[model samples]
Target: MEFTTALFYVFAAILILAATQVITARNPVHSALFLVLAFFTASGIWMLLKAEFLAIVLVLVYVGAVMVLFLFVVMMLDIDLDKLRAGFWSHFPLALTVGVVVVLEMSAVLWRGFLTVGRQIHGDSGNIGDTKNLGLVIFTHYQLAFEVAAAILLLAIVAAVALTLRRRKDSKYVDPAQAVKVQSKDRVRIVKMKAESDRVTLAATEKQGN
Candidate 1:
């Protein structure tokens, strides 16, 4: 077998192992680490496919940023592993059905591309993984779709913020309107009183004791 094919198998094996560990690992941190490994291996596979941009992005964005964030969150959060596992069996059937549906859908879409005997559809050969070309194509050919996707992402962000900002009894927040309208007198009171001497304080204390 060719070196590239061998490398593909190696990466694929590592990816499968890492993905399995991601789901099976007891510790959330360990699962996150395993997911990072899976992303790395998947990046390698993308590199092998000459999708250099995708590979770099997978390494930089998902592995570097997203996975690091996931690791930090997993490490910081107090996760009850038992509680997490408790509902797993209960949801297994639904999960299995969804998984099967996804697999079948993906297979249906991708099986044709995997066929070696049939005439394969060739893409632009000028620059296989050129970021410039990719950007131009996206901006020119799929500009509307891209803009729609961006809008959708923005909407999702807004929705997420709205959801998290739901009024809670425990959440302490200041009203901006009230804060802006507040006067110095409302915030602070100046009580002009005579400063008593320590001797007077002691006499007062003694009198109180008596």
Candidate 2:
């Protein structure tokens, strides 16, 4: 086998193992970590296929950002494993049914498709590095779609921040809306008053006279 084929098999095997571990790990944090590993291996496989853009995106978007967010969420949340698992057996039938259906559908698709090993689409094409070409297509033909996606992501981030900063009845927190609505009259008071030094001097003069 060629070195590229051998490397592809190595990455595919690692990807499968990592994916299995992701499902089997008892701890949620460990499962998230394994998922990151799985994503990395998948990126490697994509690299072998010469999908440079997809491979880099799989690693950067999934492993760097999404998995970190998943780990953060899983770690920050209070989860009762035992209580959560209590309904597992009861739900097993439904889960298994869904799983089996998905598996059957995937298997049927695979059966219909012919498998060819050692065949690459690029096949040593000088333009194997299609990252620049992909970018041009995206920014030129799909510019509107790309802009919309970015807008959606920005809105999601803003919404997340708003939700996180929302007021809670039990917490001692200031309402930003109320604060913003406040006039200078509500926030400040102007009073005529003598200086402390003047007040002290007047008091001392009165005492000496007495």
Candidate 3:
């Protein structure tokens, strides 16, 4: 086997192991670390494929920013492992169904690509690592598909925000509409009190006279 092929297998093996550990690890922090490893390995695989832009982006965006945030959140939060695992069995059926559907969809796409392996649809064959060429191809040929992906990403973002958002009794949040409509009278109350006599002055005057 060629050295590149061997290197590819090595990266793939490490990626698979890291991904497995991400789900299997007992500690959340350890899981986050493994996920970071998986991202790095995947980026290495992308680099081997000559997609340097994607590899760099995977490392910078996922490994550098997203994974660091995940690590920080996992380390900082006081999470109950038992409570988190309690619903795992209950949700397994739904999760499994979703996983199968995703796998089938991915398989379909990969099958189509495999069937067209010999055909080179893009005219520019030399610019493999050029971001400009990639952009041109995406914008010109796959514009609709690109727009659809962007819409899907937007929907996913909204869904994630909606799912994670909860109103906690212990948490305090202000309503922008209410804040904008607030009046000074509602927030502040003025009270008038008569000044008390200075008994120390009276005592000093009495002492001087005595």
| Winning model by lDDT | 3
lDDT of candidate 2 over 97-119, digit per residue (tens): 99999999999878666565344
Instruction: Output the worst ten-in-a-row residue range by lDDT, candidate 3.
Output: 120-129
lDDT of each: 0.87, 0.86, 0.89
True-vs-predicted CA distance for residue 3, candidate 1, Å: 0.7
lDDT of 1 by residue, 45-157 (tens): 98898789988998999988998888888788898888889999999999999999999999987986677536632335545466777787788878999999999999999
Off by over 4 Å in 2: 108-129, 139-192
Which residue pairs in candidate 3 collide? none
lDDT of 1 at 136: 79
Alpha-carbon TM-score of each model against the true structure: 0.69, 0.68, 0.65
- Write one digit per residue (lDDT tens) for candidate 3, span 1-210: 999999999999999999889888999999999999999999889888888888889999999999889988988899999999999999999999999999999999999999987775463864545677788888988999999999999999999999987888999988899999999999999997755566777878899999
Task: Provide C-alpha RMSD values for all models, in order.
Answer: 5.8, 4.9, 6.0
